[model samples]
Target: MVVQDRRGGGTVAVAMACGTGLAVGLLTSGCSPDGAAADDQEPAGRAAPAAAEVRDSADALVRAGSAAVRTSMETASGGTRVAIRGTGGYDFATSTGRLRVVLPDPAGRPSGGHQPITEILAPGALFMKNRGAGVPADKWVRVATASLADGNLVTGGATDPLAAAELLRGAREVTYQGEEWLDGVRVRHYRGTTDIGAAAAAASPRTAPALAAAGDGFTTGEVPFDAYLDEAGRLRKVRQWFRFANGAPKGASVTSTTELSGFGTKVAVQLPDERDIYAGKIASPTP
Candidate 1:
């Protein structure tokens, strides 16, 4: 019972707008429809905090995470394979920013089939199926824009990086919760609440309909995260869990995994290079 967040819906729009340009690892079928990248784990025994506090924390966390993400659009792998790693810079607008393919279909490899159109989302890049069944090695499509940036000029999403950041900045209260061990790291966790009324006002008079909707805020959406805060109160590693506006049930949770947090760090942005774009040197669809 996962309530797909506006992100999933936004992800689809990205696939449509890019018209199948970049991205990989977007399993159109297997992945959650609402866009919860992975399984939705239910949190336990947590008191609700004031909306203002949570929004402020989220913004602080996003800011601290600036240039901390190993930003890339990659494939799901469980074996020894080389997948195309499309790298990019974070706009922190919370909306997917500029993502370039650092590795295209490796030299003399057919990767079109496995590469589908994806929205270079924050935290990681997402590829949604548009042309082929799943991602095959033969259907890989490259960018043909005059910008020759080898990336899509993406624009869409109920919540953009800037908007999301703003809401997070206004975060008010924080309810101490539990914790989880990811990749062998034990992290502190908590859920922060938000004030939809205030959020809507922050959206401003002429905010885009979509951005406003996200900013217009919800009656109650949970901002769950593991606070790895800096000395200055900036978050270092944040695992964000977003639920429906009213704490209905399970929705989508995007975990922001990172090791550093700061502004103006040496972040990498490039187009997909063939050699580093798919299953261990670009695995061809099984014959």
Candidate 2:
């Protein structure tokens, strides 16, 4: 697996042989929700509609078929911060998507000279291009999602858009915050905490393994999130917070955000042929 140096000046190709250690390196190196109802206010003491709507957010997207997505993942440690941003489209029905992710600069800013990494997301797998370091630019590197400690959630830099919505299924406590306009669309805002274990149990089979891995990998199974849903109960935006053991006593903190739009968009994602995948060993990054 290839990861950007903490300074963002170069890339490090960590051998897959390192196994879970690679996941820790990715987290320590700073490499790393749903919507609600319509009414402006829910009557006091009334059940928050989001409690139920959030769980169905993924189903709503499946019904929509596809949508364009924008994702941002920010990690902070020892006063240094970096972010990974991505843009592309997802086919919810097929559980596949593609994104071009841009790594941060030495200053942890998105305005960097680093080339964008193209990522192809599929059930139980991830394919990346321009992975840097020893990998050929034209050859894709594939990794199994179930093998990663974080289940490719933070390891891929940008969280899978669909996985982001599915996490909401575990919402244990949710409060509808009210309605707000997001990109000219009225959406209901909700805040809650989700249980990773619960989400994995409730997730579709295609996503269950990854979510299950996340439950075991993160320092805690509880995740805090904010979600925005449109009138149709479609997820418009979500932000989630995660923490993992990054070799630090207190661990590391990551904030992941996903925004959705252009519903019903036509998205064509083609996986690379076996011949196009890189089969050679990856060299380790220099000290």
Candidate 3:
């Protein structure tokens, strides 16, 4: 297995450990509510129709064909916090995308500015370049998505754009949180908790395995999320909260946010050949 050396004071390592299926320290946190009022609640106290619409957000993306994506992942542990951000585009029809992820320098360490890592996100596999710590900068590291506990959701530093929307397939207890203006576009906001197991069972065939892996990887089954959808029911923005054990008495918290825009944009991604992938042992990052 190739372990990409992640910078940022061990934050990435801790997050990746949760996906390794290893018995490491655990991190735990409460699922607190975010204050938001429903502009229009369901009639007779029944489930809102918006709930059903939220479940189909992923399908809406597939119809859109492609879009630009921005991702932000923040992990908090032991009084330290680190963030990873990425920008890219995804071709939903082909289930492939590419991102340039920027990693921060380790906290309190001398700054020798780090390079952005290029990541290729495809079905059941993740390819990364500029994987530091002795690996050739030109070589890509390939990791099977099914082999990951978190299904490469948190491990790759940024969650796969389409996978993030597919997660809504299991959305429950959904409440319409009114409409808001985002990036000059009007969007309806919804809040809810999604069951990973349920999502795995309902997700598209190509995405089921990854969600299944995540259902078994994380300590908690319920993931709370806030989603913003356009009038056309396309996913405009989403924020999901996750907790994983990191070998700590009290585990850490991770907040992953993904933003989508420029629907129907052109996204071209090329996969690396087998020979270009690194085959040697990957040196782990120093603590």
Best by lDDT: 2
Candidate 2 clash pair list: none
Q: TM-scores for all candidates?
A: 0.38, 0.85, 0.86
Per-residue lDDT over 43-144 for candidate 2, one digit per residue giving the tens place of the 0 to 100 score: 467454657888889899899999999998765544455567899999999999999988765455564667888999999999888876578889988888
CA shift of 216, model 3, Å:
1.1
Clashing pairs in 3: 25-246, 25-247, 25-248, 26-245, 26-246, 26-247, 27-245, 27-251, 27-252, 28-251
Runs of candidate 3 with Cα error greater than 4 angstroms are 1-48, 77-80, 107-112
RMSD to the true structure for each prediction, in A, is 12.5, 4.9, 4.5
lDDT, each prediction: 0.33, 0.78, 0.77
* Residue range 1-287, candidate 1, lDDT tens digits: 00111322222101212333332222222211123223223245424332333445445544544443332222211211222333334544343344333333323132432342333443223332222324354333332321211112111111223334443443445544445553454544434533333444564332223333443232234343334433343433443323222222332222222333334454443444555333322323221
The C-alpha stretches of model 2 lying farther than 4 A from their native spots are: 1-48, 78-80, 285-287
Local error of candidate 3 at 114, Å?
Answer: 0.9
lDDT of 1 at 273: 50
lDDT of 1: 0.33
